[model samples]
Target chain A: MSGAAAFWRKYGVLFKSDWAIMMAYRSETLIWMVGAFVQPLVSLAVWVSLSGEGSIAGYTASDYVLYFTAVLVVDRLTRAWDVYELDRDIREGTFSAKLLRPFHPIHWSINGNIVYKTFFAMLMIPSWLLLAMFFPAMRIPVDMGTIGLVILAIALSSAIRFVIGYQFGLLAFWSNRATAMYALYEGIHMFLSGRIAPLSMFPDWVADAARVLPFYFTVAFPVDLLTGRLADEPETVWIGFAGQAGWLLLLALSLRFIWRNGLKRYGAAGG
Target chain B: MIHVEGLTKIYRVHVRQPGFVASLRSLFHREYREVAAVDGINFDIPEGQIVGFLGPNGAGKTTTMKLLTGLLHPTSGRIEVGGFVPFRQQNAFKKRVSLVMGQKSQLIWDIPASETFLIHKEIYEIPAASFKERIDYFTEMLDLSLIIDKPVRQLSLGERMKCELVAALLHRPDIVFLDEPTIGLDVNMQEALRRFIQSYNRDYKATILLTSHYMADVSALCERVLVINDGKLIYDGAISKLIDRFSPMKRITLVLGAKIDTSVVEAAVRNGGGRVVAYDYPQLEVEGPREEVTGLSAKLLTELPVIDLTIEDPSLESVIGLAYSEGAAGESRR
Candidate 1:
């Protein structure tokens, strides 16, 4: 088989294995889901209260609910914890086993993340449905064109975030405290990705700065796609896709560069 | 096959001292020292042979294993395993070899050992039918059926080690590198692992390189041994040769039916050209003068009340200790 074909085959098996492993710890998985969902739910509640009696920054109370709910789903779907896992693996010499494998270790991690998100999103859908039942405003348009764009944006966002996180994880091969650096990266990501609020709600300068970076493209841009924020201008929708593509390419290059350098250092340390 | 020529690995270690002042000083001016972990070792092994890598702690056995498996790169020299440069980490080369460390584990902690086995099957891309056959064979050989389904965290160290061996060999690699594969196991478990490794080598004709502090592991499984000390090869030859060369004396322990004066026995053995090595109540141990052990034994039988007696050659541990002390003394002299 070709390398790509073998990769996909191995990835498929890894995904299934992670799924089974996750299933065995269903309660812990559910607790983690609840913890993640609570963040967006709390944001929605706070935003709704702040928007009482009038729209704030052109977003009504119901729009805030929909936006933050979409934020939860998008965040959950694109989540990548490979940095933490890699840090643990590197420190404990478990990475030696991974290095022995025939395929790149990142492929296994990506498969693990994808499988985990798929199962997590399944559990999340019912909560979304129940919330939609009580709040009609949370419903999005069923237009096929916008829905297709949302799917594309989501796929790119997942790939970009995964590669970016993987690149950070590879740093563990060189440094002892990779998780600390990862935490700092995530702290920057929170504000730049508009996790707390829409970019428009931020100061004009802040929002403009975030636009040029890739963080907003990872989370907010896809959320905007689902909320019909790109409906008025089809060209801007393509621009969002372009941003996703550019960031994906950049992060892929960064991941490759860091992995090579880190492997060199790892060889030295182990030798 | 494996070839290592002038294989060397150097480590740059940062030196630090305790105290706030020292820590502050270190931040501005760090001290670095170059430690040679493996210094220019050369060896070659043909296919399907089991070679014991014997070394004391920090003698670079594990480092060499890591380098051979592509987990590490040598500071200098070249190494080839299974006809490929190990440090290059070629996919085909990796697929043909496996490394197992007894102190570390690869099995997922929260899951059954079967989960790890399945994952390995997928990672190695074994055919489903072949994977099942291998799993069946390993399970039977390792006696893993009873514990394979239980969570790995719940298994005893010995059981986990058996499972670990099963996991390592399921891919059916042509070369296997094992580092202390029986470090913490009891005697029975250690023997079982030794037997499993021997059978695996015999059945598959796989080349094996094993490093263990346990001399029994080498004595039981390996015919040839490589003894290293202070990052240098001190001895490399047959296991029996190592024992015979380092240890020139044999031990004989005798039990007396009656309480005999220990001094009289010691005097007799000393007079007979044998050295009295140790003496306990009702028992006498003697070493040296192998040529006269028979005469000494006969004389003791006729002159003293003898109950039972046994003779033993020097053990591998004693041989290794002798080698290390000799190496230390040689270094001090230089």
Candidate 2:
């Protein structure tokens, strides 16, 4: 078989195994999703109350609802817990099995997250639709071209965030404070990635920084693409795709760099 | 199938004293020292040979195993397993080798051992028919039919280890590294695992390198043993030869029916060219060279009111323990 086919074949088995594990902890998963939903839910409430049925900084109540719901779903789908997992694995020697595998450990981490997010989405989509029925503002603005571009953007966004989180997770090879490093990264990401507020609501400099930096490309840009923030200008939406692609390329390169160096350190540590 | 020449690994460790003041002081100027975990060890094993690596804790056995399996890189020298440089970690090289650490588990703890087997099947690309056949065979051989479907966390240590070995060998790797594969197992469990390992060697002709402090594991399975201490290879030869070289004394035990004077028993043993190593009225123990055991036993039988007597060679535990201390002392002096 070709290498690509072999990769997918292996991935299918890995995904199935992880899906079983997720299913066994279905209740715990629901509880965690409840916590995850609170962020976007509160953001929507605050924006709606402040807007008073009008527009706040070019965002209508309806726009705020759509943007925050999209953010919540996208964030859930792209979440990475590898920083803590890697830290614990390295310290406890659980990483030995992963390192001994013929494939890179990141593939396993990625596969596990894919299974978890797919399960979470399967559980959450119906609730999202029910909420949309109760509140018309929560309904998504869908189009064929927009859906195609948004799908590409979400895929790239997931890849970019996964690589970034994985690269930070590799810090555990050198120091015990890898989780702290990830938290610091997430602190910066929250403000710039529009996890706290939409990029349009940020100060002009912060918004521009989010655009030039990779943070907005991961969360806000994809959320905006889905909400038709770039609706009128098809060219701008395409440009956003190009920006996300560029960041994905950069993060992918860094992931490789971090992984090669991290393995050397990990091997030296005798795990 | 496996060869090593001057293989070495040195770990750079940071040293720190344990106080808040010392910790603060270390932040600016840290002290580092290089400890050689595997120091220039050399050995070779042809295909189908199961060589036991014997050592005390903190010796280089595990480090050498890790280096051979490409889990850790060597600082110097060369290692070739199945004609491939192990540290390169090439896909073909990896697929041909396997490692099993008794203290570490590769199975998914919350899932059945069979789940891990399926994952390995995908990773190794084992044929579907062969995977089924092997699973059935291993389940019967290891008596895992009842436990293979249970979650790993729910299994006993020995049962989990049984599952671990099956998972590792499912791919039929040509080069196997087993580090203390029966560390905490019962005697029966250890024997079962040893039989499986021996059978694997016989059938596949795979080069097997095993490390265990348990002397029974080495004596039962390996013909040639590698004794390492202080990160150096001290003795590499047959197990019997090691016993002969390091321990030549034989022990004899007697069960006296009536209480005998300790002095008389000691005197009788001394005159027979054996010393009373232990004595308690009705029981006496003597140690002597192999050549003197027969003469001494006969003399003790005739001279003392001995009810029954038995003789034995020195245990492997003593011979190996002596080898490690003597070898490590010698290596340090050099």
Q: Residue B152 in model 1: shift from native, Å?
A: 2.2
Q: What is the lDDT of residue A67 in candidate 1?
A: 90
lDDT of 1 by residue, B1-334 (tens): 9999999988887798999999999889999999898898888889999999987778888889998998887899999998999878888998899999988887888888988887887778888999999888888888888999999999999999999888888889989999999988999999989999999999999999999877788989999888877777777778886766567777888888888787788777777668877778777887865566778777767776889988776665677778777663344221
For each candidate, give its TM-score against the true structure: 0.90, 0.90
Worst 10 residues of 2 chain A by lDDT: A262-271
Shift of residue B121 alpha carbon in model 1, Å: 2.4
Give the Å error, residue A83, model 2: 2.0
Tell me the tens digit of each residue's lDDT in model 2 across A102-167: 777888998988888788778777888899999898887877778787777877888888888887
Give interface RMSD for all predictions. 2.5, 1.9
Looking at chain B only, the TM-scores across the models are: 0.86, 0.86
* Model 2 CA deviation exceeding 4 Å by range: A1-4, A53-55, A60-62, A268-271, B249-321, B324-334
Quote model 2's TM-score. Answer: 0.90
